[model samples]
Target chain A: MRNMIVASTSTLYGGGYLEYLTPFLSKRLKAASIKELLFIPFARPGGISHDDYTSKVRAVFQTMHVNVKGIHEFEDPIKAIQDAQGIFTGGGNTFQLIKMLHDLQLVEPLRKVIYQGVFYLGTSAGSNICGLNIRTTNDMPVVQPSSFKATGALAYNINPHYQDPIEGDQHMGETREQRINEFHIYNHIPVIGLREGSFIDVQGTTEILKGTLKARLFQAGKAPMEIEPETDFATLNLNH
Target chain B: MRNMIVASTSTLYGGGYLEYLTPFLSKRLKAASIKELLFIPFARPGGISHDDYTSKVRAVFQTMHVNVKGIHEFEDPIKAIQDAQGIFTGGGNTFQLIKMLHDLQLVEPLRKVIYQGVFYLGTSAGSNICGLNIRTTNDMPVVQPSSFKATGALAYNINPHYQDPIEGDQHMGETREQRINEFHIYNHIPVIGLREGSFIDVQGTTEILKGTLKARLFQAGKAPMEIEPETDFATLNLNH
Candidate 1:
């Protein structure tokens, strides 16, 4: 059994950091009895320091009386994950995050604890790492990771911060849908385009879509479909 | 001596494929006395076959009375580049293009021919490979190449299809400028943000900006500057 929140964004447009997620997370924290969490700040949004990223998250959790600690602060990171009751991976560059995770040889350790039923929260780049691989990410490859393989905590991949094509948009760059379509050529794994302000609330095997916005579901050799907010992803049978 | 057109895109918005570039290229072909050329259609847009992509390019070049041969048609791809007096690399997916060029071990041969005074034209993903590396490309990493390295025919990297931030964009995804800022933190290489319709025309050592719009020049630890249409990129001193 797994309990997790795979969020599309850490901060909504014009919203304070973790402001939109606090109420929902507070309810989850109480339900799971999770008073503290180990934060993975390797992504470092805007190239911010690990300490700064952790402090930002800590400040938000403080409002809920839940403690947050950076994984870097620990002498033994693998032990930190093993002993933690909860975890949250913040947003930033996925390549940077994956490089560090592989460099420290923490992929297996992190995946092991997640399966052991640790309450987990992943936002943006954080949500990306919980996929089968990070090939669907929208971020620029600023650094090269050892491989594109990621923790298979989820059956499929997540395309976080997914935006629809703007009407009359003249930009020649590939649209989000087009990029994902190109990805389908190389990979058959189902990809969920998680729009900002929405998330997948995983309780046991049922992955329910949360928030009012409609999420896009893209699969190989199939037309992209609009999925309703209350839909349970488990019903889709993504596994081949 | 080097002669090349590193174009931002193969197809201009609301225009036919290679239509906007035809006149510019027709004159160059005549001046260089190049009646025939080799085409590199490896970056198949929308996953088209290499032969199909070459057909599209061949039809366009046929309008100029310039015979076109795809590198795939030749038994020895390296010899094709060596014998060709002119070359044109069509645009599509940068990662796919880089992987094929590297897979065939043709990076060095292609770069050598460019400097050997071949009249060359590159658009979109084609233009991206002329840079120091592929890190600044806007294309999706659908397929992982062996490395992020590119031909390095040009000293600086190219950010093709560069778009300006839409006023009041509600989406929270990183802007083009913001993404480049993150790239600056990890790399000091100067990046030229080539907007649609803009290209750098390299004649010998002087890479002069062409087209009407101004290009965005990004240097690590410095402000992004707007370069005029006639400005010579060789004056930037990018080698450092």
Candidate 2:
């Protein structure tokens, strides 16, 4: 299997949430001699249409000399992925993404594509689907999903947009750390707090952290730790 | 005209992000002689049906020997609110509530009800509608509304479920205070951080502070200050 890349942000040209990957993504696809890339924009932000947002992503792929297509354009996205060379799912609201995934029954196809060695990449909500469930997501549960299930693309849950706590505030609401901890209380799955610039590059079954910042890992009844990018995170042997 | 009562929590029953308010709500409603209460449970946490959540609020009113009707029960909620004696919007999610209010054209009706002597009581998302916009709300923007407009019942915004800042956490996301500050940057509305067990009781044109604890008030380009519930907040000068 050639493997997949699950990123916390897009490898876009401008200052995107995942601007760090702009060069890396282009270099990898070119070196791999990849001709076409599939894009999934199901995690539509605020329940808005996918066309406008995906167009921006398509433009990014065009710059890389790679053919790009938004999966929503296909009547049978499952079959489209089955016959695709590579895939990329952009980020947005996790709730909306999961909702559309469930509604369209694309979660299973996505899982298949990753396992079939189709070279997949997911950013933000795309990265979130790499987990067993979307419960660890930082996105608010604005709309209830048909299911909290995801593609199980990774062994651990992901808390994207991971942020450091602020000082001298007494608002008493749950912090992002607290929110992730709540997820741990219910699921024993290890959580990877992927900072804005972080991503996990997967080759076959081996998951490699690819970024400068350290990703925080958390499991049930355990303290969180920071591990540098390029670390063999999949070897942690901390499966739930 | 009768004033408004914005609460921090809903049922005083089982729910996440809960705040206690039975003693506070009852005292103010009785003092205002608010007998008929219109219940709006449109936020519907967990995607529970609106009818089921509305019934629970109705049960609360029944226990208090007050006549209650769910706004959903009305053929035209806008007209119903116009003729209703009082209004009580229960909390769930702010985004959903604001979207529904905008979709049904009930925002103006709600504003008129509060202005035309109908006592208004909102808890959580319910309380959020009292502001000029839902910008300072804690709920996730699951769905986008036609506009960010709200009832403008209060001169300032309310950040309920306010928590103190967590110490020694490395999560680098924007804190609730920071998010509210961002809202102020784009707009000039002030925000009031009302913690659990805290509330605001307005009668006539005067908005008096209630509850046992002090609420934090923040204005654009100004440091936040703790104001006791008993302190006449008339300096805000919203009432005319």
Candidate 3:
């Protein structure tokens, strides 16, 4: 049985880091009897040091009486994932995270433990690794990874922090929708545009859309459709 | 001698496609005595077909009595670049364009022609390839290319369509400046953030910043600086 919390953003507007998801996240940790979380800080938000990033998460999880440790501290990262009670990959740069994961040869080990049910939690760049491939990420290519292949924990790709076109904005850059649409030109995988504060609560084979915001779903050769909150993604034919 | 016009965008606010650039573009073609232009439509903005994208450019250039032909129309694309009097590459998806260019092994041929004094023009994704690499691109990682290396025609990378943080915006996604700073974390290469309406005129050994807006210069471990219009980029000690 797989258990996952794939979030669009770690922190919401006017909220502290992970403040909005604290209640639900605390409940999940307690339900799973998880006391310690192995945090993957490879994404390195703002290029903060591993210890600094880990401490940030530690401060939040400490409120729930759960200890947080960064994987970088472990001698054998593969063993750390294999032994962790729960895992949380914080968001930053997807390219940087993927590059390190691939360089350390942790993708396979991480995938194995997740399938065995290690309680995976990911936000932004973290959530991106759960997809079939990171071909839908909105992050810049800050670095080159060995490949775009992700953990494949989920069958589809995730577009986190997905924003709609700004009404009457003068910018010439492509909108989030247009970028995802361009992805469809070369890839056939389904993509879910998770707006800020939105997430997917995955338990076993059932995946439910959480939060108040609606998600946009784009499939190959089909017009994007809006998915309401509380909708079970597992019910949809995502294989297309 | 290299003669090229690398623009941040093809169209500007409240302007038609290439309308803002038409006057300057017309003068350049006439000065070069270029009657026929070779167009590279591989960027495929909005996923438009090559023929359709080429037609759009053709419609505008026809006003100047200049003929435009897509490289795809030629049997030997390498030879097409080698024989063209002038070339224009429209913007779309940088990764897709790089993938095709690499897949077809046209990078060398394109570079050879450009260094040989073939008048070249590029916009958005097109202009991105003229840099040292495509790592600074704002485009989504919709596809995985064999490599992030580009034409290396320019000494530094270009962050096209560079925009400042929207004042008081609620979006949690990284702003263009933050994104570029993150890029500097993993890369030592200098990056020039070209704002909309800006173009870098590369004539011989000098690259001058054109247009009304100021470009942002980012170097490793240094605060980003503002570059005014008509500033020569070659004068900057970018090696630092």
On TM-score, the candidate that comes out on top is 3
lDDT of 3: 0.93
- Angstrom error of the Cα, residue A141, model 2: value is 2.7
lDDT tens digits, residues A151-201, model 2? 887777777777666575444444566656655544678888887778888
- State the weakest 10-residue window (summed lDDT) of model 2 chain A: A10-19
Model 3 lDDT tens row, B68-102: 99999999998898899999999999998998899
lDDT of model 1 at residue B122? 97
- Residue B173 shift from truth in candidate 3, angstroms: 0.5
| Model 2 lDDT, residue B223, Cα | 76
lDDT to native, each model: 0.91, 0.73, 0.93
Q: Model 1: which residue pairs collide?
A: none
Model 3 lDDT tens row, A1-240: 889999999999999999999999999999999999999999998899999999999999999999999999999999999999999999999999999999999998988888898899999999999998888888889999999999999989999999999999999999999999999988999999999999999998888999999999999999899999999888998756
Q: Return whichever of 1 and 3 wins on DockQ.
A: 3
Which TM-score values does chain B get in all models?
0.98, 0.90, 0.98
Residue B19 CA error for candidate 3 (Å)? 1.1
